[model samples]
Target: MEPTQWTLTETFQFPAEYGKAVSAQEVKVTAGYTEHQTEDAVRLSGIYHVAANVGFDGEGKEATLDSDAILIDDVDVQDQSGYFEYAVPLLVDLPTSADGQLTATVIDASATATDDGSLAVMWTVEAKLANVEAVAQNVEGELTKTALATDETAKESKQEVAQVTEETTTAAVTPDLESSQVETVTGYVDDNEMLAFINDLEDDVTVTSFRLNDVFVE
Candidate 1:
């Protein structure tokens, strides 16, 4: 038989709205997973993935700024204060039995100016998540059944003979487990700080929406 593969993805938003602004200079992301054992010798595992769209606001001395790698201003040199979008991928592993959990952490964040000093960027990270590569196996085995019968017969002149009969059968079995679950999570640098910064920016920086992808092959 051929082995098949599948993937599940989910998206999340932080600071849900722009009006509730905060101030920050940098953003960081972290990933984690879980594991377990099945009735069979085979091990069960869960894989996790994380990503984010960072929002930034820049100002002061007309400088350049980079938000999670997105370039805010380069050609136009001036006191820059605006938001930019940036994203990155994170991964981890764990042993999962019937079902496993997946989550995301903001870790940390901040804002700053780029080379040539073109902007006072306001930065924030909105985390994205996905649970991937979860696996399960059939371990316990199959069940068998058997039956026996006995009979007596008389032959020629009161002679008796004994006879026996037997029957056997087997059936496959299914694993004792429930369906796996997929979820979405968010991590923020500092809501108060981000709000404080956004309140001051000339314009609010927008973060791209999160997305989820699920793939399966049989």
Candidate 2:
């Protein structure tokens, strides 16, 4: 399957002085599949909101942050994006506490005055994801399969009509028949067997593990 490339772009405006940093609150965030910009497909979209407590200093205003959230289309963005998605959050050069909470940082801000005589600062953030692959279909539960590779002798053997069975018995069975079954089962012995592989996309790591459940002839 071919990998689908994705890019995320976000832009918003905040209030600030020419040289001072500005904090933005309730910044509108929107995202969608770049392909939708030109193609006709069910576009993926995301929503987010930024909030902060505003304080004015001289002619400039600073913000004490309150709440910021990025929602994935219809799915809630968790601290950890489990299984199939990756979420990497960066607060620029802002400081964070031991528990991973943003403390404070002064943003170098610029502002534009609105019709109501209010200064609006602006900000833009973007990210590019490469080789982001999505599986075409999901396989669930457990699958059990057996592969059969008959030997040359078994392939050349002729089959005789089986007797109608109330006790369940074959008309004829030979060492060659048993030997063919043994070869088929042993074919898997030297081959590489994989039980499961885990890809931790959030952390950019992959792990492969193997386990032997059972190998028996009934």
Candidate 3:
């Protein structure tokens, strides 16, 4: 199967306790997620771990901060019949004989710190769904041989016969085909809501710069 690619851009504020970061260095990000299939879409929910060396003030002193952010998105699949079964078998009912696997990889990622202390993350991912099946077939073959040889001086009426047999078998097969699709999705966290939430926090901290680490899907 060909891979399905998608892009997501999200903006959200971190808990204010980290202190307003004047600069960020050695930033790293990792993501873990689970997917569910709805009637017409696939919902992905997970957490992204962001860690970096953050500078709070003009001073050069830096502190390490590790944080987890919530991630949620929906991928439309209404046009793909039976895709849910192949992509998210755990969320759907399928026979025991059904075999499929879903895997995803983050192809690109970048992050920026907003002036208001919010962090905006953007990434692209490619997902692939593969299915395997077993097939049995009845094969028949016929072999005929005709050989004539004459050695007048080397042999006195001597003949040798040899019999050999060969068989081929296949246990499982995956069809040779591919399907490709791309989708773009954008998500935003309201500035007012984030501001209100940040105001409630005891500390007045914010992110300044971000560096991505790794992104993956299950």
Which prediction has the highest TM-score against the true structure?
3
The pairs that clash in candidate 3 are 19-205, 19-206, 20-205, 20-206, 29-213
Q: Write the per-residue lDDT of candidate 1 for residues 1-218, one digit (tens) a residue.
A: 11213232222222211211123333333333343344542232333323222332432223222233333221221232123333333332323322333333433333333333322222222222233332222121211111111122224223421221111111124332342111111224366677777678665555434454443445
Instruction: Give the Cα lDDT of each candidate.
Output: 0.31, 0.30, 0.41
Whichever of 1 and 2 has more lDDT, that candidate is 1
Give the winner by lDDT.
Answer: 3
For model 1, give the 10-residue run with minimal summed lDDT: 140-149
TM-score of each: 0.21, 0.19, 0.32
Q: Quote the positional error of residue 67 for candidate 3 in Å.
A: 19
Candidate 2 lDDT over residue span 57-87, tens digit each: 2243443322342222222222211111222
After superposition, the stretches of candidate 3 with alpha carbons farther than 4 Å from their true spots are 12-19, 35-45, 58-99, 130-218
lDDT score for residue 26 of model 2: 28
Q: Give per-residue CA lDDT, model 3, range 1-218, as digits (tens).
A: 45677666555333344333343333444555676665554555565454433333323232333344332122112212101000111122112232245555567766565565444566676666543332112111111111122343224333221111111112124332332111111113355667678678676465344555443545
| Better structure of 2 and 3 per lDDT | 3
